[model samples]
Target: MPDIVSKSRSGTLGPAPAARTPRRHTVAVLAFPGISPFHLSVPSLVFGRIGAGGAEASPYRVVICAERPGTLSTPAGFDIVVPAGLEALDGADTVVVPSWERDMPLPEPVRAALRRAHADGARIVGLCLGAWAIAASGLADGREVTTHWSAAAELARAHPAVRVRADTLWSDDGDVITSAGVAAALDCCLHLVRKDHGSRAATELARRLVLAPHRSGSQAQYIPVAVPEALDNDPLEQAMVWARTHLDDPLDLDTWARTALMSRRTFTRRFRDRTGSSPQQWLLHQRVDHARLLLESTDDTMDRIAADTGLGTAVNLRHHFHRLLGTSPAAHRMLFRHPAA
Candidate 1:
């Protein structure tokens, strides 16, 4: 059964406000038996202000609830005591379903509670495999959503109506939001905070949490990694880092290959193996992402941002931005721009 079976009478619910004057919102993080500690922590750490408190008004109140009250043990063999049950979904401004086992069947009471929450005008969010649970509730029917790239195939196979986007970090369809994978949950939650409280508030919160404020949802899930775990260090790390810092420079494939100490042919193969994208394509995507940050966080002119990102001309910037993100740079900035800091 489609999880989106619960009808959300409203089109979409934006994030609740954070200003002191507005009413505080209640956020319910749904937990169930044998869930991962990571899944439970993701939402709480993201929304609970788990770290030191911030200067801005609190975003919302977070409550941890289970299908039935009492003890809930994690797959890691730890137990959590909870006082609330399905009734916690009531009066929630937002309901978050963190990752659940993809194979687990949805309970009727949980589905009904989710449906009731939706009908009552609460925003519903599915993080990672939680999307599959959301699908089981029938709320995600015909919605463009994303899950962990590794599981996207299974999700699509299980629910053909879901538009599985394997490339993005998250998907926002107004009232219903879904994220790609484990860590992308952080990215999506921060995005919701940004959307609701403004970039300034989100940035401050991210700094407190030690997270990046923005990683555009449209970006590819595969990223170049060169951490120190491998005894034989990644040959491309230094080069990739250098290239990113020099996006405004005329960095052709030949230049990147030389930086990585490989011939163009060898570099092409190795770069694709590491990042799943050709150097040129990878560079283009990075430039676009950089341009987006400038558009959202600064008031730089299009031509200035273009030159900074090495798109060379405002015309080139617009073309690339539209081709990759399906929106004009001006339009994107207009939609996402936070009040000037």
Candidate 2:
């Protein structure tokens, strides 16, 4: 058995009462065999750091716990000594499982502890490959989740009950939260903070960490194609480059087909085959992307932005912006506008 040391809650909020009362949040990170140091460090770095300038700033208490209390070697050749064991999980309001190596199996005791924590109303988080451990624990059955793209297929194949969406950065099912790859873990953690504390607290933590406070889970993980190398004779690549720069202009099937020197039907077929979306859909994505940049980087009026992006009018812009971004143009600007102050 490992020695469990319970520290009095630090920062503001203090300790909890025996009866029902609000208290400081306890976050326990499970440091298992062959865990990535980068994955293990993220929660501690984000939740452990105290915010400057506030009486209400009660930082989360982060504890690294393991099945056994001792030093464990990381995949990177470094060693970390964790003094607390699975018993420490009893006090946690949230339990985090960081990335583990591919071949490692989650120990049975750890799995039981995680299940118990969830049963007792503690939120569970699985970051990166840690999703595999959570799935193995049988806690994520019938719940939607995601992991790194490379591991998503295997996780889905291995556990048919878990709904796995490979493309998204994260998914939240109330008590159980799962995130995709490395950087996306930060997004998920901040999301939890936002849920518990509010957007202002989460945004403050993100600002202190110098990261984007929020990125939509639905954003494409990677751009569709490699930047086409300059080819002296490649007209298709040239047309693509031209279309990107001229996104503000009215671009229709006829216009693009003429530019690409093909019939409209043939152009539509070829564009779909190459880009995995119809030419019109691709153009809409480009326009939305351009509008997003403008919203973040400039204070342009909605009407001017709409005309500039070829969306025809502010109403049209708002329609597409809401459809694609899940928020209006002005709301998007408020969340992502150039930081002033």
Candidate 3:
């Protein structure tokens, strides 16, 4: 059995296989003028508000607050009247700044509130460009952080005091968490849910949202994609679908590149540019991801899973699995294996 660390890039790892929180916690999200509705909604949705759907009441108390108590317009040309003001931060256990539009100024009061919230020990999160607001708060000074990859250079330039990482889905530095872009915010918030609540709750919520339960920040932020010369005929997309269907068979760089009808060099470059990894790494990740699903959802033997996922042998499977996930396949299976029906 492999030892499980109490921490990972996803969040704090709980020792109990399916540990639940002992108490409910409050999550407060910040709303600001000119913010996109999508950014404002990701935290609320992932913290278990929107997809609760007859499930047990979520263990989180979610609140959305703004600088003032009134209507605010979003970039989508819509308006929403937030229910609370900055004072709402007083009771929050976690405060999320979902995103920050570059032109929108971080008002001093908002910055003060974020500082006070962190001083009071609330976990602070800045998804996407919201990291800018977190930086403006000055708490992240001298801390490693990240934002949308496109803005990473500018963020570093603007806040040289803060170390900016450009290539991650999210960064978990204890109290301050930041994510790369729009989709990565979902991963970040789900990570928080898993940390606070547990794997069971997070898995249930992920099932509802149709999201993968875990994606380490070590994965690249940008994946290379090729045009394939046809808008409707995406060779890379088609190759990915084909690869999934053929996971049980031998797969190699030349085979995958051939499936896309591109030279191996072009395929490798495009794969990295779009998916943030080379073809080999992507194939290995997909194999591990598939094997995990098999471990959780099926009673298949180790050899079966290894064979089905194209790892070729159990030793190879265990070696790659433990390398990527930090836990043995048998141990991971024990944690996530489905209960008898």
Please give, for residues 129-208, the per-residue lDDT of candidate 3 as tens digits. Answer: 99999988898999988788889889999889999988667887889999888889999898777656556667878888
Best-fitting candidate, scored by TM-score = 1
What TM-score would every model get versus the actual structure? 0.83, 0.66, 0.70
lDDT of 1 at 209: 83
Query: Number of clashing residue pairs in every model?
Result: 12, 0, 9
Better of 1 and 2 by TM-score: 1
**Most lDDT-accurate candidate:** 1
What's the lDDT for candidate 1? 0.83
Report the C-alpha displacement of residue 204, candidate 3, in angstroms: 3.1
lDDT of 2 by residue, 202-303 (tens): 678788889887775332424255434666555555667778888778877787788878898887876666655677877787787678767766789888
Give the Cα lDDT of each candidate. Answer: 0.83, 0.79, 0.82
Model 3 residue 52 CA deviation (Å) reads 4.8
Candidate 1 Cα deviation (angstroms), residue 123: 2.1
Could you give candidate 1's per-residue lDDT for residues 91-172 as a string of tens digits? Answer: 9988999888888999999999998999999999999888988888889899988788888889999998878888888888
